[model samples]
Target: SQQGEEDPQALSIQEGENATMNCSYKTSINNLQWYRQNSGRGLVHLILIRSNEREKHSGRLRVTLDTSKKSSSLLITASRAADTASYFCATDDIYNQGGKLIFGQGTELSVKP
Candidate 1:
């Protein structure tokens, strides 16, 4: 599985500001998804936007995909301290049409009040 890179490896923002994390991949991909992980906890599925889809939304989470650039971005609006976590972008579980996801390093967000 190939891995992508995320920008702003670590981000510290205010409670109300918006946080944006970007991920760029290397090869072709079918689907792109974003997940959140709280400290000492399992990953929580946030949103999944297909390669064909340009943007998607789930509650306060917004995701955008740019196939031409092989990049995607996760935007969290009205951030809160509880939203402080590591966000990662992953590719479809289509390892040669198998079931395996390729994930990026991640963007560590720290929301402070």
Candidate 2:
């Protein structure tokens, strides 16, 4: 079962704009984490908000979680071209052995200068 699915597989915007992405999951989770991947590099942890938490902010990023609906949202305020990268959502499912993380296909964000 898929844990997360991000809307708008791809997005293009100018620098200094806001980007929003949504994710929906099938099962309950302990925590949901968002990550940013640059080109071909590994995923870098952006933020982790627990299921009990409603929202979290890190630098220019804001994330919201609604466990009732099994969904989450990510907001990037004042985006920059440097922020251009693929964003993924991962869920920490308690049922899996060793707690595997299921990632979304990802939203490819392109921030133009």
Candidate 3:
């Protein structure tokens, strides 16, 4: 079951601006991943962090996870209209051995040009 709950169900920002999204989840997780989807299409993997890691970055994307708080956040810098998409956080339950990921409701981001 998806236990993660994303903040700001939707967001609107202008080009060159910065967008931030947050996610909170219940229970312990082995790893957490951030994904982006455009126009209801396939998910594009953004970044992933293991329980032992505090933060990870890829391109203009930055992800931070604090296991002690059971929360994580995604930050996008210099946003563009093309960056408009829905972002979701998935978690690999530590107790679930099947490797199933539980997803959050998602944060819809709109970057206006």
Regarding TM-score, does 1 or 3 come out ahead?
3
Off by over 4 Å in 1: 93-98
Best TM-score goes to which candidate? 3
Q: What is the Cα-based lDDT of residue 77 in candidate 3?
A: 96
Model 2 superposed RMSD (Cα):
1.4
Q: Which stretch of 10 consecutive residues in model 2 shows the poorest summed lDDT?
A: 91-100
TM-score of 3: 0.95
List of clashing residue pairs for candidate 1: none
lDDT of 1 at 86: 95
User: Distance (Å) between predicted and true CA of 82, model 3?
Assistant: 0.8
| Candidate 1 vs candidate 3, lDDT winner | 3
Query: TM-scores of the models, in the given order?
Result: 0.93, 0.94, 0.95
| Model 3 Cα lDDT, one tens digit per residue, 1-113 | 56999998999999999999999999898899999999999999889999899989899999999999999999999998999999999998899744888999999999999
Task: Tell me the tens digit of each residue's lDDT in model 2 across 1-113.
Answer: 66589998999998989999888888878889999999979999999998889999999999999999899999999999899999999998767634789999899999999
lDDT of 1 by residue, 1-113 (tens): 44788997999999999999999997788889899999858999899898789999998999999989999999999999999999989887345444677888889999999
lDDT of all predictions: 0.89, 0.91, 0.94
